[model samples]
Target: MKRVLNLVLQSAKPRTVGSLIFSRNKQKMAVSPSLNSLSKVPKSSSPKPQIFNLLTTTPKTHFKFTPIFKQSTLSLFTAGHANQKPTIKHHSNSSTRCLFTGIVEEMGEVKQLGVADHGGFDLKIHANTVLDGVKLGDSIAVNGACMTVTDFDKRLNEFTIGLSPETLRTTALVELEPGWKVNLERALRSVDRVGGHFMQGHVDGTGEIVGMEMEGDGLWVKIKTEKSLLQFIVPKGSIAIDGTSLTVLNVFDDESCFNIMLVGYTQKHVVLPLKKVGQKVNLEVDVLGKYVERLLGAYKTS
Candidate 1:
């Protein structure tokens, strides 16, 4: 019995060495020879051990490594990594993106609103200061909504913008009528000072004016919005209403409503004061709050 066990142990030694090599690089390995032939591996002058590179494999599985020095970026691509061609998506009417500071530059009047030839609505607004140095494809925030300038007339001080179905569904701009006033702001420039909190000119949703009253020289305004949006609106937080940056005074979570104050100076500058109860206004919650919530959600899931 002792002699039979020794023969079995000697036969299993070679297979163990072959498996060690396969586990190190995860490559197809062949059966190795016994300990008597172990010195057959070639010696190298370099002190470092040899490392395997996958690029030397078959053409279809080969990958390329490119190092960019400008920004210290490394990119890797392989033939088998992607089976389909990459595609880029573009909006039908707009081609550029812009950001705002939630500061109303002027009050633009709605001159015309009609359907566009290529689906969606075409809006024409009459404005003064926002048109300065404006180009045909420049972005303009109308009522806290970003819109591309499809056409502009310097002499008439009017510009045309195309609105998609998504924009109409999310914003109060759908309720606009001729002669109605809307807050307008040109995209912020690198040199311009940030007078208000950062805004993307993307309206989260529309809120209806539920209550209003005068508090000495300042006016108190209450707006009722969707309950889901209340999580982002907190007392003493920043909010954008119709492109006007205002600080929230109170948040009635139970009622799904919030209140903000408009000083005498602000009342004269923005069109929010002109809006009466039951009127719909574009609302943008603080972007930071949304980002925090998204990050927390990722942690919870993980």
Candidate 2:
């Protein structure tokens, strides 16, 4: 028993310590070339064993270190496309329309109005707050009608808009003359809080201011429009007059007239009350009503 114990203790002693053994079908066990190099590294030079080369002893089996980034990264360091001008794409349909909240930003003065060299009418308006960040081809509502900014002058605080033939035939913008004040509002952005109802700045028609009277600190104004437009005007519905949003108080279908009460704040901000009776004002009814009418018409036709 003592002799057997001594033999077992001798066998337990390690013949090879901290050595990795690799096998191919268990026929022969061999140390990998990279592992052999790691074992050969001086302990004094490196606290731990280090691999000098990633290649293995077996030529058939090659181990290579892949790059952290690929060739696609080369474009990031190149400047070939730096000077290229960016292209702007525009839609040809109604989707191209810009939306507004019917909240007038400021009143702009008609500085100059004349025929443009391009055949349309060019309107130069002197404005202040509305010109901030306004660029060429941007849309601005003039008298509740959406017009594109054809040119601008930051120094003069003025901008020019082109009025097309269709605009002249549809709405009352043609009535604007030099020194006249027009309601101005910028296109709504996604981050902006919607203060009033949605307005497309597309004037459906013009309405005549038939009556105006003072009630308390508010102003009671009545406008008479055509039957075609009066059908869309409803009590408590939203209506934009000259780019200022107002709630409809009463709609007299028999008289083809509707009234709205503008608070003191609204009265001072808008150009509606400043105008006298018999003057035509651009009118845009609630878009929802127009959409409903179209949907019902489709069902009726079917």
Candidate 3:
């Protein structure tokens, strides 16, 4: 019994002992190679090699090491792909469109054709929508609302977006008479740089422009919203008002309202400066907060 106990202790001390034995299909067990054999292994030179091969023990079997490489400052980023530009893939269908980043540039022209008898408005389009891969029949966001391009002229940089009766009823766009300004953006592409939080041109609801005053080099806009909408808003969180993505500066008065400071650059660029108090604009709360709420709800119930 004492001799058996000695063997068990020796087997447990792998570093000091020579062999560890167990029965799988008890046969001749190949003892593990000693640390001396690894020390004798030649250094590897393959760039970003995941496994270290000391020596080819056989034609098929190699002594692979998945352990950390003992090297000084190994770079994970390689110099080879630094200059390679990513090629943007184009899709002919609008449904599979990439919801990348929203566009702020002044591009695309929208002209009204005669109002349809069915109660929608037809529009003629032509303008330089700087976004690449904008094929005809693709979707574009006009003034923060998604619109489908009915026709286009590539050379002239023109396309058309039609507004249905439902769109006019739900949006402040109904106020758009002849000769009004709007911001236009093509549907997001996969390669477009994400400069802001994700926004879908769906227009979750609308908020009124309550106040606009000069604070710094920009204008401070205070918007009044439903208490329900404000629940999803947080100070420094992203919210899209009037289709323009802006960060909330603060939530005021029990979260019934919020303020966003627009820099001079944004104020000058967007049609937001043209908006007036008591006028309503589209509002889309950040999608991230809702997803987080759902995930937290799952844990709470569990």
TM-score of each: 0.69, 0.69, 0.61
Give lDDT tens digits, candidate 2, residues 1-302.
Answer: 55664564476652334543332334544444333445763433336654554344333346745443445566786548768877689764231478899888999899988898887789999999999998888889999899988899999999999888888888888888899999999989989989998999888999999999998998999999999999999999999998888899999999999999999998888898789989999999998999999999999999
Per-candidate Cα lDDT values, in order, are 0.84, 0.84, 0.68
Return the lDDT, model 1, position 280.
Answer: 94
Q: Once model 1 is optimally superposed onto the true structure by TM-score, how far is the C-alpha of residue 154 displaced, in angstroms?
A: 1.0
lDDT, residue 85, model 3? 81
Query: For residues 18-111, could you state the per-residue lDDT of candidate 1 as single tens digits?
Result: 3232112235424433444455564324448756654553334367554333343232554444676776887643323567888888898999
Q: Candidate 2 deviates by what RMSD? A: 14.2
Worst 10 residues of 1 by lDDT: 17-26
Candidate 1 Cα errors over 4 Å, as ranges: 1-96, 117-119
Predicted structure 3: lDDT = 0.68
The 10 consecutive residues of candidate 3 with the worst lDDT sum are 16-25
Better of 1 and 3 by TM-score: 1
TM-score of 2: 0.69
